[model samples]
Every structure is written in structure tokens, then in C-alpha cells.
Target chain A: MIEKILLLTVAVLLSGCVNLHVHFPDAADKTAGGEVPTRPADAGGAAK
Target chain B: MLLRTAVLLLLLAPLAGSAAQITLSLGSLRHPSFEAEGVMLSFDAARLGEADIRLGVLRVAGTEYRALKIHCSGFYFDGRRLDCPEGSVRREDERGRDRPALPFSLAWRAEDNFLSFSMHDVDAVAFSPLVKRLRSWQPKGTIDFGLTVEGDRAWLGLAVRDLEFASREGDVSGKAILLTVAAGAEHRGGAWQWNARLDWSQGELYRAPWRREAGVIMEAAGSLSETTLQVGLVRLDVMGTGSVNASLAWDRARGEATEWGFVTERLDLASAMDEWVQPWLGTLDFPKWYAAGHARFSAEWKAGGLRRFYAGLEDARVADGTGYVELGGVNAQIPWEASSPTDAEISVAAGRLGDLPLGGFALPLRLDGSEATVKGLSAPMLDGRFVIDLLRLAKRPSGWHGEFEGGIEGVSMPKLSRALKLPIMAGSLTARVPRIAYEDDVLRLDGALAIEVFDGGIIVHQLRLMDPFGKERRFIAEVTARNLDLGMLTRTFAFGSIEGRFDADLHDLEMQNWQPLRFDARIASSEGDYPRSLSIGALKDITALGETGQPKALERVPERSGFSFGYDRIGLSCALRNGVCLLDGVAREGEGVVLMRGSGIPSVSIIGYNRHIDWEALVARFREVIAGRPGAIIE
Candidate 1:
């Protein structure tokens, strides 16, 4: 039973390693859905 | 006969006692060289009274003097001679308080037909009729002279003071002239042979591009006839400078010099250039120069054209004020003829062009008419040699044109870059140029130049330069770089390192005054690349170059193993126009472009959303990246 438990732990660790691919939201979809963040204007700016 | 008549008239006038008045009139009085018409003489008393003599016309030599009047006081005659110890001369037509009478003393010896006269404070305007060139200049001066004439010979000792004259254009002028002259003349064979010595002790004279200041003495001998004036020899001694010997033949009718020549002793180059050469160089587009040396020059001119010229220099050093050109230990002997070819040589110990230093060289030159040629000329450059197989230059009616074939061999790139103030680079540069031609202020390459640098080859085609030395200089060319190692380029420019090979194509590139104006440039990874990878620093730089703001995707990478990443391909393109660059990447990924694509584990890709960017802003960002500043985030 301890050998089987060790096998299951090894499998879980391998699965975690395999699922490590990074995921980023599509930039175009974010812009289309009005979810893109806008940077704030700096204070104390000189007038043109 | 005329002198005898004048003596008889003076004797009869004095015979009339102190209280007696006498008047005499004659139709005309004539001599071989002197004549007078409508002559009259009148006197009252013999001691204190005045004698007035008026003549409608007085002709001396070949010039006519009209309305001449001579008024005499204390006149006396001794039967065979006449003397007027106090006399004054005037012109009837002159009407101004400033026109004062000229004082004179005269004695005539009837025995030998000899005349002696001395005049004081004679205005130079009185002789303007004889010197046609002075009529428009409005000469103002006073002259004092003593003249003695016997038969066909004459002698004059003259002194001029406070002379001032100028032309309307102000190109020819003189001021504060104090001149002393001793001249002698004799008439023979219907012409006058004359010689004079002139000393200009204090004055300033300007004749167009030539100027003269005080302390000049000239001794000249010439013959003047009806049709020509020939100066046999003229020796000029200028203060602080050497002498010059010259001669000229001038045509009186055409008012031009038919032939002229001059030979100068070795002159001090510094003084000569300042006083004479600089003024004449105003029309040429050349920088101001300072020189030190001694040189001798000779030239012949005929029919208003140069016929032959010769110049020799010794131990010369010349440098421009702007530090663009300099030469030292220069010695040369150059001779040129208008109709025949001549060979010459120049040797230089050292020189510099821009910032590049040059070693010593001796070059042979050939000149004929308006053309010059140089064959097999070689000069030492920075750790290399520049060889010119042949060069030919000719002066055309439009301007100057030339052609040359040359090559640069084994020049160290690092040294060249340092000299040019560019980034330090590795390897050596070499180029072979087939031919370059220049015409109409434009220089163009007839064939492409293949240059080896950065372990690759760059072929430059359609290269042209316009007004290379002028303010509006321009350069145009197209270049193709093949298999350039990216590591070396990035290291040279201080860009983050990437291990790969790339090829670049730059088409229709143009620059004005060394600033880029337009170009279409594309850089892509070379085919069959090896070990293609980018470091973390390089990845951040690439991201900053393309994206407006930092992407959250970069933060997702595990920090433990974030040293480098493998890349499948890299590509970037920029088309510059109107101060804006239209940018692109390798391929489309949804609505963005893939700047870099990952190929292995722990790899990452960059996507660019913006397509158009300000060129100046882009360059600023690039500078910030190269300086290792934090990546800029813009919206």
C-alpha cells in the first residue's frame, strides 16, 4: 500500500509539471470587450 | 624763333619806363613742340606793375590747353634772355574760390633755344586731359615739379602729396599718397623712350582683388608710341617681401595688355598669402588657411590667357582653420603649359583628412592644358594602405569633373570607428571600388563596392553624393548585408546579446547632411541558423521595442529558470516616410503581429500591437534600451 501511495504521488507531481504552460488572455478580445486598462495621467503636468 | 620773339617782347615792355604802359599783340607764336594762338602781352611800369599775357589756346606736345592765362610780376629782360621771377597761371574757364593760382618761375635762353620752368602747388586735375584713366576718378592732389626741355629731350623731378582718388565702384582707390618721382624721356623715331623711379612712402591703394600699402618702390623703363606702350622691365621691391621682375606690352587702342610675364624671388608664404593670395581666393569655396613656407612662382600670359606657369615650394606647412585638412613637410615643383604636357611631383611627410591620420607619400602628376592625371598613387592609411590605380581630372566649361579607381585593404575596423567617433567594432574592413565619377557637383559610383566587415559581406549599389563639401550635402545608396553575425552586431551597439545569424536589406536609403530621411529596411533570421537563443535582457529589450506597455505574459514565466529562451525565428521591417516608421513583424497572430516565436520548453513569444511609430521617439526608446535603463511604458 505504501508503494502504491508513492506511485500516486509521483503521478500527481508529473501531472502538475505537465500542466505548467502559461496562459494569457487574447489582447484583441480584451480591447473589444472594453476590459483593457488605461494608464492614468500624471499629476502636476504643465499646460501646453 | 618763338623764344627770341618772346624775349624781344619782354625787352620792349621793360623799356617803357616805370610810368609807361605798353601793349603788344600777335596772331600766333609757334615752335616745333610748343604753339600759342591769339597771344597778347601788356605791362605797366617796370618794377612794381603787373604783366598780363592771355592766349586762347596753348598746345604742348600733343595735348591742347584752352583759355590759358599767365600773369607775371617783376618781369625783366637782358636782350638775349627773358625772366619772370614771380608768375601765376590759371584757366579762364575755372570758376571756384578753391581754384587758386599756381605759382611758377620761368627763364628762356634765346641763345640755345633752352627753356626752364618750375611750378609749385599745381593741381593734379590740370593733367586729367592727358591721363584718360583719371577723368572718371575725380583726382584731387597738389604736385610740385621742375621741368627743363632742350631740343628733343626732357627731364622732370616731381613730388606729389595728400593725393586722394577713387572710382565710382570703390574697387580702385587710393588715399594719403606721398610719392616722389624722377623721370626722363627722349623722343626718337616718332616714339618716346621713358624711364622712371617711383617711391611710395605712405599710401594705401586697392585695385579690385589686389591691395598695396606704403613702402613700395618701382623702377620701370618703357616706350610709349601712338599705338602701343611697351614696358621692357619693371622691378618692384615690396616691404617685408621679396622682389618681383615683370614686363608687359599694352595696346593703346584696345586698352588691354597683349602680353605679360612676371618672376618672383622666393617669397615669405605667410605674408604673401595674407597680403595677396587671400583676397583673390574670395570667389572660391575653400576654407581659410594659414601657411608657413617660402616659394617662388613665375607665370606668362598672352592675349588675356595664361600660357605657362611654374611654382616651387620648400618645407611648407598648411592647415585649415577648421581642422579639416592639414599637411606638413611639403615640398613640390609644379610646372604647367597650356599646349604641352608636363610632369610634376609633390612629397608630403604627414597629412590628415577629417580625423584620419595619413603617413608620408610622394605622388607624381602630369598636367596638360585643362586636364590632370595621376597614375598608381598609394598612401598609408590606419593600419592599411589605400591604392589608386588611376585618376583623371579635367576642367570643363560647366566646372570640374573627375574619375578614379581605387581600393582600401586591411584597415582595422576598431581604429576606423574610433577615428570616426562611432561605436567600437571588431574585425577589419576591406573594399574594392571599380570606378567613381564626378560631374555637375555629384559623385557617383559606376559599379558596386563589395565591403567585408563583421564576418560578412555588404554590397553597396547605386551610391551617389551631391555637393560633398557644401552645406546641403546629400548621400544616397542601397545596401544588402548577408549572413551578419547578430552577436557581434549586438555587442558592438551595446544591445542585449542574441545568438543567431541575420540578413538585412536596406533599399532606397537617403540622408541629407548625415541625417536619415527615408529608407525601407528589413532584417530577418538567416536560413538554417544554429543555436538560436536570446537572453532575458534581450527579451525585455525586444518587448520594449514593440509593445506600448508591459504585457502580463512576461511575469508568468517562472523566476527560477529565466536566464534564456529559444526562438524559432526573428523578423522586423520598417518603412520610413515623413518622419514616421511603419513597422511590421514576421507573421499575423490574431489581431497582432508575432515579433518572436518560441520553439522549445521555457520559451516565450512577443506580439506587437502598434504598427506606426514616431521615428524620433523610437530612436529615443532604442537609446534607453542600449543604456540599460528600465523599459519605458507608453500608452
Candidate 2:
């Protein structure tokens, strides 16, 4: 059990040095009449 | 029907003014609705003030009308115009049905081929055969109408009062409706152009299609054209507690809505749940969660399902009556379409959860069907920053699941302890958890959470929590603390100053509702550690662990020997199970073990003879040690 804890602690310390990055898409332009297209059909394809 | 009735009445009026006995034979007249034949008119023109006109039979559509009569009074006719002051029309029936006498007035001009007619207090409900042929449902109402026809152009206006409409097939019924309508049509240049205006008041609909509550007063105005039908606006007030404004346009050919929108203005969420949401979900109660907000919503639907839907909320707040949870100053905008990630930005200015004061935070969320992902969300917590790396929450058929990774860094332990009402402990705590996942109400952590405290490191592993949000929650974990400076730990709790290095292992620890259920805990001196000594107060507290323990040589009531005593080693263990702790000591002494062994001048030692102890009693003993009242251990 002590060995397992030591291993987990080491893994957590290693993960602390790493970071994950995410980029958000730009918002769509708003019009005077509040007309905007639905989601772009291919917007989520790259994300998936 | 109005045009045909006017022409026949005008022919009778002129004959009554001839002042001579005349037999009038009228040829057959054909109309799109019916063919009229065998028409004979006879009237004495000497007394033109009153006339009695009778027709044998009039066929309209497929229904045969027999014994149709018109009684006219104060009738006048000239070469160009005919007028009737008062008249009554009736169609006799064989079944002895009592029908109301329709009172009407008519004027006809032959020079312009023009006719105008007006009728008042017409009980159209008595025309059961015509009503049955027009619609499947029965409508009881009183109608007042006027019609004018001039050379291929027509205008009609009608009003209905006290309308009661019901349908047995649809289980729908409503009462007290008033409707006003006007329509005009012109047929010129081989085409027909038409327009209509419909206005209704005090209309309450039952069993409406969506989200419409019963007994809600609804007002609507719209117009209809040859190509499209439009609802200009519809306003509904739900018992004056909530309201909605909506408008829509329908495509005549496609028979579907082309453009539709609605805005909810200041709806009381509690009352709304009582009226709509609870009934729709078939749930009895909403668990004391409520909100009041104003929202603007718009949607466009095409041949396919949904083209676009948008909703924005402003000045929204949610809270419970008990003040346990609250959220205020919430604003959000969400836009969704077919097969696209529903990305939305949400901001909450202030909130509270279970005695924890929450600060303002903004979150960017993307939802794809059942999964939701939130990235880089951070908030201030207890003089430190609580940061989440990546959180993915999923909604499954049974319930909800989540995966979260985050850490609390550089938090002041003393401040946290004060906030949580814990025993004052001094240190700066930094904890990092790599991964925590939850499923089926059970949360599991993959990696250890390392906490730097007490000039040492404590690692927590194998942590699992069941029903964390439910009434009864259970926690299981294993903790190991190494090389903790004992002086610091002792001073933090004010548990009788002791000088040594400490190490411990707490395994198989289980707690239910924050109360310990079972654990195997052992604390002992670390190997080759520093100046080992125990204060007289500390020695007295250690001896109190057993029922009868006395180290008389260690105590100095006179204070002549100072306040300290030497000890070679000190250790104790409790293997707790079922509210009982199986006690043990460091070194074997006879059948038991010496819990504390004194080494040098003015030496002292203590032994524990008791093997079994109640876990709660041992806890109380430790509390007393912290209170500086080590009671009578030498006895």
C-alpha cells in the first residue's frame, strides 16, 4: 500500500507540471434584425 | 347565401307595390352552391305596407329547404330602388324544431347592381344541419353580420358573442369568447384578391398544444391573405402572475411555421413550476429550487427539424426558501442549431452553497448532446485560487456523471480551519488532484492528492465517496503522513508540548456522515530522530490512554526537577472496528506493551494494560489532552 501511494504521489507531482490548452471559436457577428445562421455544419467535426 | 336571399327579397318588395293582382313566374336561377327552380310570387299591391311572400322549396347545397317564408312590413319600391323596413325569414322543419325568427333589413339599387343587407341577433346555433356540415364540433354563439355586394366586389363583417366551443374527439372545450372579423374580396382581371382581419377577446383555451396553462386570458390579433397567414401578436397573462408575447407566420403551401418567436417577461419560477413544469414532468414537487427571470427566445423551423434556436436571459436569480443555496446576477446567452456544439457563456456574480461564500466567476461551456465540457474555470476560495483544468460532465439515461481535474494552491490552513470551525492548525496547505471521476453517484479518484502541511507531506489515496449529494454520504480513504515535526503538530492542537519526529499510517479508513466507522491507525516515533523528550503534561496524557497507568517518577509537583522528562521511544496503535479500538503499545511489557519508555535521569515510563477501548471514549480522552486537563492518570 505504501508503494502504491508513493507511485500515485509521483504521478500527481509530474502532472502538476503539465497543462492542457483549449481554443474557443470566435463568436458570430450579430445583425440589426437579429438574423444569424445556425451553427456551421462542420464546426464540430474538427473538435470531434 | 346573403346575395341570393337579397335578390329574392327585392323581387317580392316591388311586386307588393304594383297595387294589382298579379301572378309572377320566375325562371330557374343557377348559382355555384344550389339551383333554384319553381318560384311563384303573388301579392296584393293595394296594401303595400305589408306583404307575405312564400317560396315552395329552395335547394341549397345538398340540403332541401321547404316552406321558406319572408314576412315584410313598411316596404317601398320605385323604378330605381327597393326598400324593406323590417322583415322575418324562416325555414319550416318537419321535426317541430323551434328556431329563432331572423330580423333583417335590405336595400337594392338596380342602376348600379348594388345590394346592402344587415342582420342582428342571429342565433346561428339553431342551424344544426348547417353547423354539422361545416365542422365536426359544436359551437354555440350569437352572430351579428352585414354584407355589401357591388359589381364583382364584396365586403363582409361579422361579430360573435358568448361563444362556447367544444370538441368531444379532442377533449377540448372553452367558453366566453368574443370575436370580430372583417373580410373583403375583389375578382378582377381573371384573378381573386382577398384579405381578412380577425380579432378576439377574453379567449381561454383548454388543452392547448404546448406550455399553455388553463384559464389563462389570451388576446390575439392577426391577418390572413391569399398566400400567407400571420399572427401579428398574441399576449397571454397567466393569472396575472406571468405573461408571454409571441408572434408567428405560417406558409400556406407547406403548412408549417416559417418564423416564430416568444419572450417571457418576469415569470415567477415557483408559480410557473406549479402551473406548467411540474405537471408536464409528472413530479409532485420541485425540491425548493426556484428562479425568476426574463428571457427572449427565437426559433426558425424548416422542412428539417430545427434551423436555429436562440435564448438570452438577463437579471436572473435562483434561490431556495430556506436560504441554503442562492445564485444571483446571472446572465447567459445560448445559441444552438442542428448538429452543432451549443457554446454558451455564463456569468454569475455571487452565490452561496452550504455555508461557503462564493465569489463572481465566468464560465465558457460547450455542450454536445449528452456531454458538457468546461475549460479553464477558476474561482477565489479562502485566500487562494481554486482552479479546474478540464471538466467533462455527461448526462446518461439513469443519472449524471462527471470527470474533474483541479487543485487548491497556496491556501492558508488557519483561515480554512477558522472558516470550517475546525481546531486551529497553522500551515499553508497546497493540494493537487490529477483526476476525479464520478459515475452512478460514486466518485473515485485515480491519483493521489498530495497536501503539504505540518512541515511534511500527506498523501491521500484510494478515495471513494458514495451518494455524495444524497441524504446519507459515505467516504472511504487511506492516508499516510511522514516525517511530521511533532513539536509543530502538538503546538497546533495545544496537546501538551512534545519534542520528536512523527510518522503515521491510517489505512482502511471509512466515515459515514463525517463520523468515523472503522480505521487502523498507528503513530510512532520516526527512526533516528532528534532530541526526544515528553513534558510532564504530555506524559500524564499518554498514561491516560489505559484504564490504570501511573508513571509517578515522571511527575514533579514541586517543580524542582523542571517540567520535562526523557523518553527513548513512544508509540501507540488503534485497530478500530465496529466502534471499538483494539489498543497496543510500542514495546512488549509482560502481556501488554510499554507505550512510553523513559531513558535517562529522572526517568519514567508508562504501560497500557487495557487491550480493548471504545473508539469514542479514546477520542474524548484526546480532546481532554488538547484542553490541558490531563485528569488523574497517575491514579
Using lDDT as the measure, the top candidate is 1
Q: Give the interface RMSD of each candidate.
A: 15.2, 29.3
C-alpha lDDT of candidate 1 relative to the true structure: 0.73
State the lDDT of candidate 2 residue by residue for B552-614, as single tens digits: 443323343345656777677766666555656666667565666667644456665545555
Task: State, as a TM-score between 0 and 1, how close model 1 is to the true structure.
Answer: 0.71
Per-residue accuracy of model 1 over B1-635 as CA lDDT, tens digit each: 45565666666754666676666675676654568898876777654447887787887756677776778887755445667778877776645223556678877766776678887877877644334445578888888988776767777788989888999998999998999999888878887788989999998898987888889999999987878999999999989778899999999778799999999988888888878877777556543677789888899999779999998888988777656678888899999999899998889898887778888988778998999898888888899877778888998898888998987778897787787767766678777788999888788998798776666778888999877545566889988888878877776776666878877887778888556777777777777748787766666566666434544555654454336667788776766665555556677676566666666654556666555555666676676667642221211
Error of 2 at B588 (Å): 7.2
Itemize residue pairs with steric clashes in candidate 2: B19-B45
- Candidates in order have lDDT scores of 0.73, 0.63
